[model samples]
Target: MEFQGARNFSIESPGNDVFSSKYDDDGHVKRTGTWVTASAHIVTAVIGSGVLSLAWAVAQLGWIVGPTILTVFSAITLVTSFMLSDCYRYPDPVHGSRNPRYMEMVKNVLGGIQCQLCGWAQYIILFGTSIGYTITASISMVAIKRSNCFHKHGHEAKCHAANYPFMIIFAVVEILISQIPDFHELSGLSILAAIMSFGYATIGVGLSIAKIAEGGNHATSLTGVIVGEDVTSQQKLWNTFQAIGNIAFAYGFSMVIVEIQASYLSYPILYYSTQDTLKSSPPENQAMKKATATGISITTLFYMLCGLLGYEAFGNKAPGNFLTGFGFYEPYWLVDIGNVFIVIHLVGAYQVFSQPIFTLVEGWCAKRWPESNFMAKEYHVRIPLVGTYRVNAFRVIWRTLYVILTSVVAILLPFFNSIVGLLGAVSFWPLTVYFPTEMYLVRAKVPKFSVIWIGVKLLSGFCLIVTLVAAAGSIEGIITDLKTYDPFN
Candidate 1:
């Protein structure tokens, strides 16, 4: 296969398979999963620390464009997710494998080089997201502590809320909890993360509505936020782009779709002993579609409610984090509670999102050091004299170091707005829009310039352009803001 001048790999090619499904001498058996489980996993992937900042995202655009942008992206995400799900399996099952990781799918559908590019993009996005979580959790902790100190000590107390010690402590917790081996093992954590997400969303919306009902004067529009009737055109344009970037970051979840699909054990045996082409069981296909729809719809509702109410409450004054935007006000306790949940949720969310990264790195390392002791299992006596447990020496040391490095970066930067925006601007289009669209076109054998094909290509082009502009705008914003904290500045 050829895409433009590049040599593409056929997903049905025997040698290009992602998953190596094993078979007994007699026949092959595959695992399958339920839609409900997939839906839960999707919810876990989509609803993360980003939700905390969506009101601030909405504040970037006025109420009119904010929700609209969100809805548009949500729709696009659903469409892309469906497409990607369809591409999850090779048409000729015996020739290939199922639930290829995102980059694996890219490799099969696009080419090896494109796969490598997708791999880099995926790592950057997920690593940035993990860093974003560290920043979010640390900052939320800082705010919670500051809120507590202010209530107890009033004006005389001084507190270093955003300090290294807190981040170290937070990082330690993450390092400890991040040891879960795979996405399938995260079912309980995902459910808890989902619940925590709902709890915080409810708290945010509840607080926002309460504040709005107080009948106080508040800045409500972009003009008011900028504080001038003579605001320049460039500033408005910049603000719009930044808002789009932020919303993109807030809504970003495309990187984890393949991993989520893989979590389903009911692996669709899309090919039969006789058939060469793909034909998924109707129930499996419909389950995935239904799960993707239901999960995204639920996520969208949570985002909309939080964004609408939080922006309505604080309007122009809204901070990047809704809980942190509360200031040292009357509801300090609720703010503290919300911030704690944010930290907890980010911990689980970080692990969920980083699973793919961990898998890739571990696989590469294991491949390189097939006989190393680091890859060997070591048993340790269990606490309370229960039993023995096995541990991976490499995983412990490597992931701990990974968490520590991320924590150091979080402590040094400690800012979320521009970092997340920049990351989203850099990675969202390729992962969420371009790759899926292109893969679908190729796999479905849709002819070039046909109506549906043309529309998809246009969308892909538009998304690519948007991400470039967004990256530039976000980078500029980060540079400008970094002047305040840039060590060498």
Candidate 2:
């Protein structure tokens, strides 16, 4: 189904006063949604399980360095997001020349195998990052319960699995639920997404604040809490650098090629609704710049708030839990009450991740399912997701399945070292630092540092290195502990 030919719908665009771009019978944009509630898309995409690590690092780096990362990122994002806002700048699609997308943009600017390879590489990282998050969220869920349960029962078989049931149930439920089609419009998912993000931040803030306010009792000594005090000076220096890097990485200013297109009068609808919005958006500097700017602002706000609050509560010698993190310390209760919300959050994340492919699927579906009732407004409403999905559903289905399976892995994997390593190296480094810039580089020919793209990559690299080293140290100690002590296994 080629959705490209379908008449452009006006309801989904960000420029809509109400934020709901739904069109009317005459194809007029809907004026209904007046932004009643704040959204979490900004929060969800930016802040995740990485907050704990970021929070800890913030404390180590002090209020200055930590906040600096966040503030700098926010400033950069503000520019990027506004530029993204300008993607609508071309007097709207109803007026004139539309923008091109990642492939098109890169093809236009830096055509060749490199951009193509980058396109493919970025798809992997973006989808992989999504998978990693799903895995981490699931793992945290089970681990939190198990950690608490084990502390009491001593790792008995009854509760040995740690959220095993939730994993099975959650994945199946999400799968079935996802099949139900949109709960109406993209905004619905946006709401769900916002909650998950807010929930994560809320919990972390609550825990950190509780611990910090309590003072002393919840605070763990730096050396003691981190676990390896007497490592070589190089390692120690490296660890400190890692902490700084995490801060920098969290400063998420990137040259986003995707959001820019959204602001463009001619950006493909798939860009906003696709499985890979970043990669799928128009690639021109105007488009890319706009996307990066939007990403920078929304993401920066989320990261900065999370960092500030997380640091407040968890920073500097503090050990506490966040909402999602709470599921780690107190699972059943947290899951029982928050799971519904958490489920929403996961769905939100899934939808956002699925967009890259979904948009493509939607695009294909449109081509395949040519509008029988062109005048029918529903055609406009459904076309994007279907079009993109049709183009990429097979991939989406597998990635979705992969996400679920990996989440299940989270339930089973429990080595502190592995967790830290994954959290730091696998999760934090890539998404925060590596992914943004590397992905953007596909279209970013000259790669200017002044651009958020440069900042994101530079910062991500800085963070990735530090996080990996710290994780490596922690993992090594765990290996040694297992060999010598063998506490339970």
Candidate 3:
């Protein structure tokens, strides 16, 4: 978890090739990542199931507030990302010690309670994201079935498919994939997930444009859904709050910025050189900043297109998930393809988010029970083509239980938009806005009561308020949905 300074490790190896070609100044493997690679990672991380709710979010806030909220959240993510990027190297931006993990950076810059808070916020968000992904993958699976049903039996036929079975199937897949060991093993999966994300997003945007081209007028307004005609005044207020949460969720990728930057380093070795060698040019912080800007810009553009165009296509009645909500029933094949892409993307994405938690808990258990075989033992199992595999009983049982728990939670609360909104509202300010701002203040030593200080504080305060109300609204939405619904029905 912690990286000692370069001076502590012995870098002198018996060969010139190892010293010259393999290691960096910091004793870790040489970093080969560029801003382009980091941007690609960010794009993959930032765009996920959250984008599916944007049209519904836009419908809630209407034309004026909808796009504005998206823009504002985008700006907030970019600014905070820049702050966290600079924190990657401490004391000095170019020459200071590298903090590869987010918690490590927080501990170095803003230790004590702040670091603990960051850890809690980060892990909670990751856990909640697993549940959200489960619900999303199931919905997509059901959508695929429903799309086929609609195509076969006419669009008017009943095509109700329970989400529970698909959710269980997805959870079973995750339980098996969860044994992949660590993040280093997930590089190919991450790339494929990123591609799938783009595929589905493009499909969504293309479908929305096609819907718009059909020239069907969708009633929309500057202020969102009308009170009497569409929703009650109370409902409108709650929905607006929930919509803000949805946007917040869409922009919630700040927690992993440090990890993404750290990923630039190939894998750490046992020893490092004592002498200061040349580092990757521009520093990780600088490259990460560029990546953050580029990635967020691209993500926001996609968000605007998908959200605004989908809103234009469906107007105030845009379903929480436009693809699965039957917004475009004619192109059944396209819808099915989009849903399939979603399921594939979420499969990889679920692992990406959940691996850290697995590592954290498993590491803690190993430390706590160093002498126990249950925690430290590995069993080798040989397969036909996969060759030998190492499996631990503790890992299998613990990870399986974790997957089952998340799946059960998803089954209990299957409201997609509401769950997304709640998770976003719960995490956005604490992880995205407040911690990064505080860390930046400590790192830069900005004078108290200065203009920058006041502005950031104000921004953090406003976001906290947004978080509170958004949570309230999402909770209300869930409660409203629960009234007429039965769990496991």
Candidate 4:
């Protein structure tokens, strides 16, 4: 369908002149994305490394609180996502100018120092997520090798593997994928990553079911791991906080929702030939809300399955990452396959989270030095099978260094659960709850001191407390891990 104000332009036209007619009303390349592609992108970003930790989260919270917390977080995520989606366009959700990035939306809607705060929260979360994904990817890679070794030898075999080498390998892969340009070019990769996410998640659920059917009993209770027997009182409190953080991490795709909603491909000229008779595509906010609902529904289902079934199968002993943590070892091949899917999904996910940061830095540099060819120049290199490729010196160097830096960080502190918890705790309140709620209040013109306003503020306040406790727990856990851990060993 053609956009309402879209102009018909010949596709053969060359140079910048084509941009005026070929682009959308906001000067972006025409957005061809529907709710389906949007949902794919959401699923790819949301159902990632965080899902692997849900089993452990559940083990800490126990069966009742575990499922309840997961459901509550899912509901919170859905509400906040809908709020953020509406903010994609400015004054009017339907007709206002587009705010393609999250910070852009914050700047336009909230303005002032709020934008700077949003930038720090958003970019730090994105950067930390890249590191977390790197750590998780290397873990999965090591899991595959160890799984094979266990099958060849026995469960008693050491089968030890170093995560550093695999981390470097994963970083190299990300450095290559990082050059893909922007969110507009990530549709295919996101779709593939979404599928891979489902693959491993399904494998994890299936293995959990198999293990449960085997009828072996495990230690379990309504209150989770016993404080006196399994852990100390302080440890219990800390673990509960970390569990909350893990759940928070699993539901955090809100930061990128604006970017995903803004992603659009150019429509073919043939289809737009009869522009007068064509209808505009569905409004972006509407599409994003639908995608959020669908994606969250699908992910929450998998999360419940993975977390609940995994808990039932392994009880309080559930590993942080059920698949790679060797919770299911007999079907070693299936475990290996699951790890492979994790690696592939993370490769795509790393790009999804990193692209916005790349855009922000690169955009800032270009604006700062418009005359610098080193920052703005594009070198075209054509391979036989592939079409012409645009290579920028600054992009190549900056993104490569960024990947390397994250890789080194992952190597230095390779605690997966703690890192995920810390990132989630740091980002969840500000990015997920507070920003969206405040933005919605301003954009929707919610009356001051009204019931809705008070309720949202209360929600935000409660989440702030959660963030504090979760951050504390994650930090404590990291400190504990570091005591026995040797960096880069």
Clashing pairs counted in every model: 8, 70, 0, 2
lDDT measured at residue 357 in model 4 versus the true structure, 0 to 100: 82
Least accurate 10 contiguous residues by lDDT in model 2: 31-40
**Candidate 3, superposed: residue stretches over 4 Å from native:** 1-4, 11-22, 261-279, 326-328
Give the TM-score of each candidate. 0.82, 0.56, 0.93, 0.86
Error of 2 at 487 (Å): 16
Q: On residues 1-489, what C-alpha lDDT tens digit does candidate 2 reach at each position?
A: 112223763344454445423432334333231111111223334554445456555544456656665565455445433333333212242232233344443344335664565456445544544454454445455555655665567545356444446556556655644543332345555555556656755655555455456654344332322335434555445445455444433442222333221321123222431112222224223333443445455666556656566656543443322343443343345433443454556665555554565455555666776663332123112455454222234443544665576555444443322344333443344433343344345433435655765665666566556556755654554454456543223
Q: lDDT of candidate 4 vs native? A: 0.81
| Candidate 1 local lDDT, 241-349, one digit each (tens) | 7667877886666655565444422121111110111133443445667777888898899889888788888877778788777646658899888888887787777
State the lDDT at 231 in candidate 3: 98
The C-alpha stretches of model 1 lying farther than 4 A from their native spots are 1-37, 92-97, 153-160, 178-188, 222-224, 227-236, 261-283, 374-381, 385-393, 486-489
Kindly state the number of residue pairs that clash in model 2: 70
Q: Which should have the higher TM-score, number 2 or number 3?
A: 3
Candidates in order: C-alpha RMSD to true structure: 7.3, 9.8, 3.9, 5.5
Instruction: Put down candidate 4 lDDT per residue, 298-348, tens digits, no spaces.
Output: 889988988888888888988888888652378898899899999998897
Q: For residue 427, what is the lDDT in candidate 4?
A: 87
**Candidate 4: count of backbone clashes, pairs at least 3 residues apart or interchain:** 2
Instruction: Looking at model 3, report the run of 10 residues with the lowest lDDT sum.
Output: 267-276
Give Cα-based local distance difference scores for all models.
Answer: 0.70, 0.44, 0.83, 0.81
lDDT per residue (tens digit) for residues 1-489 in model 3: 123565666643555466657766656677676778777767766777789999999999988999999999999889988888777678887778877666777889998787898888888988998999999999899889888888888878888889999999999999998987766666677677778888998999999898889887789998879999999999999999999999999988775465543442221100111011114686767777787888899999999998999899899989999777652377888888889889999998898778778888999999999999999899899989977777999999999999999999999999999999999999999988998899899899999999999999999999999999999999999999989887766
